[model samples]
Structures are given as C-alpha cells and as structure tokens.
Target: MSLPPRRPRLPLRARWSAGLATAFALALATAAPAAGGKARAAEPPYEARLAPYYGQHLDWHPCGKPAPRPAAGRAAAARERGFSCAEVRVPLDYADPGGAEVRLSVARKPANGPGERLGSLLLNPGGPGGSAVDFLTGYAGEHYPEAVRARYDLVGVDPRGVGHSAPVHCLDGPAMDRWAATDLTPDDAAETAALRRSFHGFADACRSRTGELLGHVSTAEAARDLDLVRAVLGERRLDYVGASYGTYLGAAYAELFPRRVGRMVLDGAMDPSISSRRLNLDQTAGFETAFRAFLRDCARHEDCPLPAAHPAANRALAAFLHALDRAPLRTGDSTRKLTEAQATTGILAALYTEAAWPALRRALAAARSGDKDGTMLLSMSDAYYERGADGHYSPLMAANAAVNCLDAPAAFTGPAAVRAALPDFEKASPVFGRALAWTALTCADWPHRATGTPHRVTAPGAPPIVVVGTTRDPATPYRWARSLAAQLTSGHLLTYDGDGHTAYNRGSTCVDTALTTYLLTGTPPTPHTTCH
Candidate 1:
C-alpha cells in the first residue's frame, strides 16, 4: 500500500472490484499554516478577491458522449436521469488570487422531484484522485436514497488535478507497467536500490510532466476548491457525503468554513491527528485485520485455498507471495507475469470487502495450481491501479501520489529510515509490514515540500457531522473513524459492526437508515449509536 496506492472509493454493486481498491501512503512533518491562515487575517480584501470566482455562473451542458455497448447503457441511464456537467474555475493557489487558475469538473443529477427541494448534496467518493464526476453520474447520483435525491441535487466535483480536472500525468503505460512490477519488498541492497529508483523515478516523472501543478494539489487546496464549488452551486451551506480520503477532504472544508457545514457525512473516516507513519502502520494492520476476517470466512468454505488455522493461513499466504517474488507466475496474458507486488495488491484489494473473498480464494487457488486462472489475481491488481485493458491507466495512481505526498512530509526520509522502522512495521502485519514500510519511502524524493501536516481538525462552529465507521474496514481502520468523531466538536459516531472499506449502503439497513435520515432531515445519529 505505497506505490500505486488506493484512495478509498464508494463501493457500488456494479463495480465492487473497482470500489474495493486499497493501498496506503504515509506523511510526517511539522505543521504548516492552515490553508487560509494569512488570507483570513486580510478577510476584507481576500473575500473581495474571491468574489469574482464565487459570483461566476455555472453553464451546465450534456455530459461527454457515452462509450460503446455496456458503458453506453450506464451513460444513457445517466442522461435519462437528467445528469449534466459543468466546470468551475478557482485560483490555483488561494494565496495568490491573481495567479493562475484551474477549472474543476462537476457533474450533477438534478433533483427528481416528488418532494420539496432542499438543496444540493455534494458527494465525493474518495481517491484524492477519485473522479467525483464519474462517481456522481455512474453511481451515487442515481443510487443514493431516493428520498434524499428527490429533494437534493446530487453533485460531484472532481478536485483539481484529478479525473477530468487538469489531471496529473506521470508514467505512460509501459513505464507504469514496469513501475508496478518493481519489487517493493526488497530482499537485498541491490533490490532496495531498485525500489528506491522506482519511487524516485515516479516523483521525477510527476514533477517533469505535471510541473507546478503537482505542488498545488494538496488536500488543503482541494478543500478550498470544494468551497469554491460550493459557492458556485449557489449553496449557502455545504452538504457533503465523503468517503475514505474524501472524509479528510470534507473535514478540511469544515475546518476552513465551519459556518457553511451542513449535514455532512464522513464514512470510512480518517484520523487527521495521526502522523503519516502512524497512518501507514495502522492501515497495514487494518489490511491484516481484513485479511484475517477474509480467511475466517474462507475457511467456512471447502474450496478455501489456505490452511484453516489463522497462523498457518498467514504463513501460507506469505509463502505464496514469496514464491511469486522468487519466480513470477504466468497468467492468461502472454507478455505479463503475476509478480509479488501485483499479487499483494490483489490480495489487499479483495480484503476491502467480504463480497470479494470468494474471488480471492479462487484466485489464490488458481495461482497455487499454476493455472492461467492466475490472471484473476493480475486483473484485481490492475483494477486497483485503475489500469484498463488497453494498458493505459487512469490518472488515479499519479494523482494519489501527488496529493498524498504533498499533504504531509514523506513517512521515511530514505531506505535507512525504512530499514530502521521494519521491526515495528513487521509487528503491525507480518505479511504486509515490510512492503508497506518500504512504501513510506515513495515520497522521499518528491519535488515539492509538503504544504500541510498531521493535526487535529475540530471544526468548532460546524453543525453535527455523522461519522460512520466499519469495524473491520481495510482501507480506513475503524479506530480512525472513532478518532475523527472524537476530534470534531459536533461529530456523531455511527458504528457499523461489519466488514468492508465503508459502512453506508453496504447492506447494513441500520447504517443506511441512520445516514439517509441524517442527510434528509439534517439530524445526526445519536451519540455512540452502534448498528449491526
């Protein structure tokens, strides 16, 4: 969970594999001034400068053309649902209102009325790199609780440097393919060197291709952009539903503009107070927790691939991955072989949701049998990377690294730092520790210094925000949600005693009802509300 990491996205029944993509990145450094620190000091002029952006009208038009066949159906459905797209312009650097600007892409499905309209409900499906536009038109826009959708326009804005909003580009297909194959859990000094090169190369590529934009893509900036989008939509208060990293983004917005917060929901919430190193270690353990849950479920089935005993199962899985590292396995594709990194990624991906455990079992069994069925493992990894059949990748990974790296200082300064931390990491998860520890080195050579740091976000004046947590969520640990809820002045914790990356709409009626009720009526779940 380092290179080509997963930013949590809202899970959709039609796209579980894509939704469950999971990975980790760490940040550790001194705190920087808040996003609008000085600007707030000069409020009069600052507000005057931003007035132009806030006053601009949105010119919504038809969304882009639908793709062929299968995807066209979804596109047509979006159209029938009255989905529209627009762009909002915001300053690239809020500090300099007169400087360069960037356009954020927004998609909306207007309220389909049968009830009095309340206002817009902005949705973000994580991925500091996830395309909110896609999330809106493809899933949440139509699938959200009808009661909420009928009154609230479901809107999604692709944060700057993500998706259709001036996306960050780094490695091309071939280069990305090679980078993905690079061994992360190095076994020797030479291997460690190679691993370092891969990370440095990625950072260099991003700096070279994305230039100044890379430095401006931090989560703070994205939060400011969110405010701009909120104002442009003519919404006096920001009503948002953000998952995974989106939770952090939403939190930032609340911290920046507490008065404007309204009926916000942060599912699979992250603890902003933790350092990047702590975040990585916690996420590694989280995946281990998820994997154990998966193993327990798998053991109930006769076709389970690993040993039934937890220790044996863990050892067996580790052994299998090590085997792949030693000798890559052939998949259905002629040119590609399933490497340890990809296999690890695939395993973590499945651990995001219980629904994919059966598939993971099949994939592991096939790989162990040395059958072409191993391609399933590779496909899962590709999905986590958002890599398409044509070998091109969505800018998800590039933008994930860019935003994450800029959010805080690198977790590890270099290989030596990672090496020293290995024991603690290995203790976190025997299987994932070393790899995740090494992943902390990914941003060591990033061109820009981090603009923000790990700190508590206590949006003092914000209204009640429902913070949902899944007990065994792989990407965002359950404790993070607790921590986030505890940190916020008006945060309410909605506990879902279940598995998966997020809690809402994942078949927990208790979770869905509570969240939907809050969103529709501006009521937060009761404190310490637990749902099974």
Candidate 2:
C-alpha cells in the first residue's frame, strides 16, 4: 500500500484520465485547511459568533446572538426526534479573523441514548462542493448506525459557496446548455481554436458571474469554517467522516488540527502527494477498468448492445460521435439538443456506478438506432454543472471547480501544453484522452492561483484514522485509498474487494458494519482488514 514518493507538477493536458475528472463537484468540492504548529486558544467549549455575521453581510441584521442550538425538519426521526439547525459565523479570511465574515449552515441529529453522549460527528460527502447540510438532512442522518446515533450527534454543514450558502452560480439554463454542448475534443486547428474560445468564455463567465466567491472558495477557507462549526457544536474535539474528495478535506483537517481529531474516517481517499496529472491519469485507468467491467457484463447479457466485434463497436461508436459532432439529434424538444458532447458526458456518467450500466446499455442501443431518449437521460446524470429545468444548479459544479482550482497548482496554461501531453494521455486512455486533456484547460485560464501546495498528510499525534478503498473504484481509485492509508502515520487500510466510487454505502454489509463499529465505539479496524 506504500505510495511512490511524489514528484513535481506536470505540464497540463500531457496526460488524460477518467477517474481523475472528479470536480469535488459532488464527491468533494471542498477541502480542509492546513494545520500549523501553534495551538489555538481554547474558548468556552461552545459560544456562538454573531457580531461578525452582522458586521459583514450588511443586507440583513440578526435578531440577537443566541447560543448554538440544533434544528430538525419533520422527516428527522430520533429516539427523541427533532435535532436543530444553527448558523455559525466564521471569518471570510482565516488570516484575518477580524475581517469579513461568512455564515455556515449547520444541521444536527442530536444524540439519543440512556448512556452519556460523546460529541458531534460532522459528515461530508466529498464533492469539494457537496452540501453537507443536505447530505445530513437527506442521507447520512437516516443511515448512520443506531449505536453511533445514540452516542454522538450527527452533523452536516453546507461549506462556503455550496448549497444555501453564498453560492457561486455562473450560467443560466440556456447558457449552460450551450456550455455543456461545446465540443470537448477538437479534431483540427480551427476546431481547437473554437474549443479554446469556449473554455475562455466559460472561465470568463465564472469570473464575471461569481466574482468574489470564486477566489474565496478555496479548501483552506472551508477547513477553517469546519473548525468554527466544531467549536459552535460544543465539541472539544472534531469527529468526522469524509468520502471521495472528503478524504482530502479530512486529511487537511487532520493536518491542521491533529490534536482535535477523534475517530475520523476518510473513505475512497485521494493522494495529496502526487501531481495532479498523475492523479488524473491514475483515475483514467481506474475508469477504464470499471468500464471494461461494464463491457464484460454487457457482453454476457442477452441484450448486449455493443457489437461483438471490438473493431466494429469502436468504429461505430466513433462514427456516431462524428455524426453527432457535426449535426446533433433534434430530440424533438425545444430545450435539449442531443450533441456528441452530451453523449460523451453520458458515457462518463455511466462509468460512475455499476447501477448505471443498464442505462448506459440502453442509451448506447438507442444511439446506435439513431434515437436520443436513452442517451439524454444519461446526459442529465452527467449534467451536474448545468442548471436543472427548475433554473438552478446544485451549486456543486461551481464550488467543485473553485475548490480544486484553488487547492492544487494549475496543470496546464493552454492548448500547447495539452498537445504536448497527447502521447501520455492517449496511452492512459485512448478513447477519452482528448476530452480529458481539455479538462486541464479550465484551470490554465482560471483567474486564481492555488493558495496551497500538494503536501503529505501525516498527523503524527492524531488518533487512528480508518481509510477504506474499493479494489476497482473509478473516481477516487483504490490505489489512492491505499496510498492515503500508507501516507498517514496512524492510518489503517480497509479493503473492499469490489467496485464503484465508494465502498461503505454501496452495498457491502461488511464495510458498513466495520465503519459503524468504528464510529460508534472508537475502534479502528486492524490494519489491512478486508471486507468482501
């Protein structure tokens, strides 16, 4: 499980990847802040910060400073029922706590037990940009182990620039439709120029649209906010579970607050030591592995759609892409146009979950028959960046880009770098190289420079952190999980001998049981534990 020593950053687009394309957009759009040697002053375990909230957002005045309390919606079920939601105001800039402020939306499912309660367990579903509050209210609270629930209050917070916070939406519906439809893999100089124009336009739109929020949505800032939430929750220490990009956040937190960590779990981890290009390339290989698994399953099915002849299947798929690239299907609808980019987007989406295989098969079958309905549905799955029909995005994509672009150094500066990387990227993913190569282009033209550098996260004094990895995970690959586990001094690697983005919630009872036991009882699975 030992990872190779990290290298310097690679020139962007020189490599391509599949599992590598994660936006932190729903998987981990935020990152935890860096830790320093200085110990933070201990305040009353929890008091609310309200004056800063009033001084900053001149738009509204607070009623009064209330002590941090929990809020619950109707659907929340408890041994007692009904937790609380609160706003914890933190400085917009950690370097200057007296400066501007931002509001963090925090939700809690309080402890319900005859036994003494522990503290809050903050949960994040890695999308650098995923809504912790939404994940809390909708998913983690209901599914968490009953024992864990009885002892610790489950908490979720919407990170800055994420859902219901000061969001960073750049495009409206029509504009988004066009953006998603833009050709990703250009064939020639002219087309490449057009692609570059689109990339610049997209960056410009984000800058012009999001303005201040874009630069402010760095992972370091979000990490500080998490500490604020931890303080307001009356917890002397922080306990958390972070998945996908959440691993990075957890690592960042552990790095920043080693002494405060209590039973942290970073599942489907990301390796912070590797260069972004290497990271993306490994992800590409992971996706290809997953897609081949899908292809194997598809080939065995009675209704297999891809041609038996690999050459024909590959050729036919290419032809279809070319046709759609030139003249997209009408779909006979006013809003949606089934373009080649949309189809590519769908294929990428299907690679995320094995449950998506049936949809991918059906979509490919329809596209082979020149119909677009099936493929369109897949496109919607891939359309996280777009505003939904209701005229709003999940704030996932915008925050995802902002966090990632700010966390790591840029991979490329322009198309020249991409062209140079073609050979390496093509070797990594022949089918997806060009498109993914363009992915690095977004950051090259980004308005912000990374505020942080890629560094190893080894909290020397932190409690044992359980790290889980699925053998063939596509997005945050299994190797990353292994690498992260090896990197941390007290990390224990838990292996899920299966597939998909994450292991615990994706049907492995063994993984679920192990994680629940750890969270509930403060026990770490023995090193190299395997769950089938």
Candidate 3:
C-alpha cells in the first residue's frame, strides 16, 4: 500500500543504463502483518468447494474506454493494444462461498507466437491499490522483454478494491483535499488533535463508502482471489511478476498453495518477518540513502541547484524543509500552499527512480524561489500517492490504508508512542522522519484490528522463485530482498547493482535477460546470484 509519498511503505520505475558504473555498482537490498489473524479459517482443499468459481467462464470482449486522466483512465487498455478484456467474480468473504461476490477486472494480450505458448503470466504493480490492469495496458506488455511476451499471455487483474474492481471510495474531493492539507507533523496538542480528526475523518469516509468491504480487503483474501484468477485463466500453476507490495501478495500465494507454484519473479521483495514498526523504520533509512544519492547526482549536474559542498548541500535541503514548516509558501494557485507534508512527499516521489531526479532538481530550484515549483512538486507527489486533479482521490489510497491496516495492527500505539520514537526516526533522516513518523500513526486508530503476525514464507514444494533487489531502493530496502531470499525454500537472488526501486528492466540488460530467461524457460538463477 502507499506509504506517505516517498515515506510511503509501498511504491517503481524500470530502466537500462548500458551498465553505467553508478548503476552497476549498487546491486542490493530490501515489513509485517498482525496475529490470531487467520485471514480465513482453514477451509476445504482446493477444487472441492470452489469448482463453480473455477468452472465459471469469462466471456472475453472489448472493454469500454474510460474517462481521461484526472477523470479516471480506461480500465481495459488491452483491446487498444490488440488484446482482450473480461471480468471474474470471486466471493467477497470466502467464508460465505455463495454470498456477495466481488468482481475483478482483467485484461490480457495473447503471445505473439513462434515459440510454444507458455501459460498466462500475471503482472501486479505494488500499491495494494495500483491497478494491475492499468499497469499491464500502459507498461507491462510493451515494456516487458519480447521473448517473455512471446511465450506467455501477459495478464493483468486489478485486485479486489482497486481500480475497475468494486473500488472503495470514501471522502469526496474537497474533504480529501482538507485531509491532505492537514499538517502531518503537528506541533502541539491542538494540531495533533486536528491530525487525529483527519485520520478518523478519512477512515469514516472509507467505511461509509465501502460498507463491509473495509473489512474484507485483506492481503490473504486478495491472494485467494489471485488463485481463482489463475484457475479462470486456465493455468495449473501461477506464472507471475509481482513487485513491491505485490511481492507480499506473491509470497502469500506461495504460502497458501505451495504445490501450485510455477515460474514467479518477486522484485523489490518484502520481508514478512518484520513488524509494522520495523517496516517504517527501515523504509525511513532507505529514503535517506536515496536522498543522499540524489545529492551526489545534484552536485554533478551542470544545472545543479544545490551547493557544491557535501554537508552544506544536505544542510540547505534540511533548512528548506524547516522553512516550509514555519511558513508554507503560496502555490501557483492562490488557494493552495506548499506545506511540509507535500514537500516531503514531493521529495519521496522523486526518490522512487533515477528518471525522476531531474524533475526533483527543477522542483527544488523552483521551491527556492516561488510557488510554481510548489504546485509542480505537490502535483508530482500527489500523483505518486494517486491523488488526482480537483483534489478528488481514488479508491487506491483508501484501499491502500484499508488493506495495510487490516493485514497488520497499527505501527504506532498513540501520539505518546510517536513522540517517544521521534528522535530515532529523525536521526534516520532529518527531512522525512517526522512526517513519516506521524504518518506511521495513520492506522493507529484503525477501526479494525488485524489477525496475522509476521513470519517467514518458505513456499515449501514450490519451484525456484526469482527474487530481485536494487541496493538503494528508496521504498523497499535491499536488505529485504536478501532476507526474503533467505526465508524462501527456493529463492534465487538476482541483484541489479543499481539505483532504483526494482532491478528488472530498469536499464539493466543483465537483469532483463536473466528475468526473460526464467520466464520463458522456467530456468532460475543460481542461489545467491548477483547481477549488475
């Protein structure tokens, strides 16, 4: 799920730099759920009670075009890309197999033949809320390596509660705008209380809009839904590419059905062994590492906006944040201003990939002078958070919070806990620690308490799972990939020594070639392999 912009717990970009030293040098790294939290009470084995769902057929057809950007884009772009679209219904609460059904929107591009066709390859971009259909149509098919695409039918399904599905809508535009504007790093009791109000306000809106769905959007439920999608797609074993938070979803799938696993790639993997607190703290350090890399790049740029000196430039960035806190500058729009929260988010958004660095530099230079950058930066960050124009939001954000909160208990106990943890978080990164620390309090007062605790996922009896990690990924840390690789029964680590959230297709021919080979041939890298 989306953390808070860069501070967000979940977030990606793909690149290939002909193996630049800066890119090749960093191949690297790497959160929780809650307990008594059996997502679903143990049920009958597969193919018994779920046969109706498995037997159901989706009548593939051309999906209708959606409204334009800021207005919600098309849910099925596969048709535009010479593919097909369909919908599959799964139980809302699996416990009641015959009860309310949740519709999952799906899209697929058939393989451009020559090679014997592999089964379907399902793709999921992170965001617990990110639209897998959107990802498939917009990026996956065209961008995924050709050999892999030729062998497997590329499939995308927006998980339950995400776009095109029965999305969970809460607050409207204006209320959401007000919620976003509330100071994340409140200074006193009154502001803190106001911040508390914003949290409750958002939660209440989501509950009201979602009804019982707010309780049903758990990760385990989504994983079960994924299996049904696999069955619907006619795949005996799931062939999947899941990134960031999707890695967690992939892990759950392997755990739930170890024998049904096929060739799976989990890039920017998550360590299911950590608690929510460790998840936030580790991500804090990650952003700091990414920001430092940005500074290094900034110093090298001809149009460099920061000071030439090392500590001096870092200090300047920190001071700019402090200035924004004291007096948020006016934006291009008179009604809106650049607050500390937005600025921090803007920075975090840029940290996602090296491609975003130029925009960050321009935004920073603008911030030093007027509100134009303020509007631009805020827009950039908000877009990353899935906040659209007109201050309206998507179920992506609402569902992000809902899924994460229900998957695990709150990271923060209360304001007192946050206050006590402030110094440690701040020391991790002076720029983002405070807002992220406060943002970690988001699910604290969550209406529901979660059931599952953090644990290792061995995926016993499964085929080799390829796990990729980028050393300085600002969102999901590299250490996570390493840890996850160790936990899995048969995880092969593919290290893209680069600066980005993920390794595959992020300009690394090495990473892409390795992934394509695995996808097409079911061949995985050697255990503990490193690629730059």
TM-score for each prediction?
0.94, 0.84, 0.91
Q: Which residue pairs collide, candidate 1?
A: 27-276, 127-130
| Candidate 3 per-residue lDDT over residues 1-532, each given as its tens digit | 1352111222232331211101111101111442224333235574477778988999998655563343245444445677678899898987788888998988888898789999899988776677777667766677777888888899988788877788877777777666666787888899999887788778788877788878888888888888999988888999999887778888888888777889999988878788888888888889889988988898889777788776787788878887787888777778788887778766776777787788778888888864435876776656655665566665666767777777776788788998999998889887678787788877876777775677777877889999988898877789989998888898888887778777776667788888888888889976666676
lDDT of 2 by residue, 500-520 (tens): 667666567799889988887
Q: Candidate 3, which segments miss by more than 4 Å at Cα?
A: 1-47, 65-78, 370-373
Candidates ranked, most accurate by TM-score first: 1, 3, 2
RMSD of 1: 3.1
Q: Which stretches of candidate 1 lie over 4 Å from their true place?
A: 1-42, 65-77, 370-373
Give model 2's TM-score versus the native structure. Answer: 0.84
Candidate numbers sorted by lDDT from highest down: 1, 3, 2
Most accurate candidate by TM-score: 1
Count of steric clashes across candidates, in order: 2, 23, 28
- Candidate 3, residue 29: the lDDT equals 11
